[model samples]
Target: MRKILATHPLHPRATAMLAGAGRLAVASALDPKTLTTEARDADIVIVRAPLPPELFQGAANLRAAIRHGAGLDMIPVEAATAAGVLVANVPAVNARSVAEHVMFAALALLRRFRVMDRDLRAKGWLAGREHANSTSELAGKTIGIVGLGAVGQAVGHIAAHGFDLNVVATTRSLRPAPERVGFLSIDALVEQSDVIVLCCPLTAETRGLISRERIARMKPGALLINVSRGPVVDDEALIEALREGRIGGAALDVFSVQPLPPNHPYFGFDNVIVTPHMAGITEESMMRMGVGAAGEALLVLAGKLPVNLRNPEVIEHYRRRFPAGD
Candidate 1:
């Protein structure tokens, strides 16, 4: 049986599928040190956790990698492609879950729900009704989406139809998103939006895309929501913006660092809502990703190309190394 190594433990349902696959192995935990040992001779590495390029060096038999979800930021995609290893990710499976979380955060921040909840719990009533001026409705507000990927499109759809909010988006795609949604220049969208939502992926060009200078251009009291990777926004700049009230509030599901240190300034801010990178983490989403990843792994192991093969050029290199006749 071909050996399949899972870098981290998956959902219990995926565990069940592994048993059925009959050739699966899982590390006891998600630490990279453990993976280096567990995956040394494995034919495939299924990764959900961040790992450095060094880990790939130890895998002599690794023919392919399957990312449990979208986003290849954690997997060193370029290195894997150079090494002739097929890398695959399941995109769009988590779009609805992530879009829902974005809406949840946007509503919470827009309405000042967390602050009011804290006050009510402490004083038995709203300590100050006067703060209503700061709390606002979601309707009629313009929401600017930074990237028009699956998650961005999903968010735009909901924002437009469900809330009747004006939707504007910026992306590399020249293709517009239906007639009602307007495509704006990034600068124009950031300045005009009442709420700016980031649903983009992190890439070399996109790192620190939302810089301090851009933050300064936002409408005063504009809400910021990021469901994308952390490095897309400069964290120190974000703290400064929040501290000075350049922006009214932010809801972030991803951060520059995971398990944000207790002393992180974002934790102390009254206007920020921070979650532990769970924008795409839902029970339903997890199951779909698990099944999709497993399917990709199976196809790669059979010497056939998997759907969503991120670096398709890897196939040409693989064929050269292994030779089609062999």
Candidate 2:
């Protein structure tokens, strides 16, 4: 039987499926060193945590690294490709979940949900009711989406149709804009949007895309919602902006650091909403991601290439490593 390793436990359905394909093991810890050691003998790895590039060196038996979700940031694809290990991901499976999260965060920030909830329990109903005067409505507001991917498109649909809000987007694609959605330059979007939602993937060009300069251009009291990877925004610059009350508020789901330290300054601000990188994790999405990852593992073990292969260049090398009908 082939050996399989998962960085984290999967849904019971997925776990059972993988178990039928190979001798599956879940990592006890997620640190690079621990993952590298545990994956040394793994024939396939279901990746949830970040895998170090060095892991491809020691894991000679590794046939593929399958991401549990759409993001490729956690898996070192270049190293895996160089080492003849296939890289695959379950793309856009959680787009609805993440898009819903963007809307949730926007509404929460606009309505001061966090502060109102806290004070209502502590003070009284009147205390919470008084904040309603400051709260804003979602309708008629312009939502600027960064990156017009599946998640971004979903957010735009909801913003335009569901909430009767105007939608604008910035994307690298040359395709025509969706009906009722206006495409704009990033600078124009920042200046014009009442709320800015980041759904872009982290890339060379996207790293630090939201800088202090761009934050400064935002209209006063503009809401920022980030469901993308953390490094896409300059953390210090955002903090500085938030400190000066330059922007209205922000809802951050991903941070540069995992398990943000207890005293992280983000926790100090009532205007800032911080989540533990769970914007894409709902019960339904988790099952879909888990099952998709398990299916990819099974495909590779059966001598078939994954449907969503991220590193297609590795196919020739991978085929040589595990010859057909071996």
Top-scoring candidate (TM-score):
2
lDDT of 2 by residue, 56-147 (tens): 99998999999999999999889999999999999888999998998899899989999999899999999988889999999999999999
TM-score of each: 0.94, 0.98
lDDT by residue (tens digit), candidate 1, 158-180: 99999999999999878857646
Each prediction's total of clashing residue pairs, residues at least 3 apart in sequence or on different chains, is 0, 0
Worst 10 residues of 1 by lDDT: 123-132
Deviation of model 1 at 294, angstroms:
0.6
Please report the TM-score between candidate 1 and the true structure: 0.94
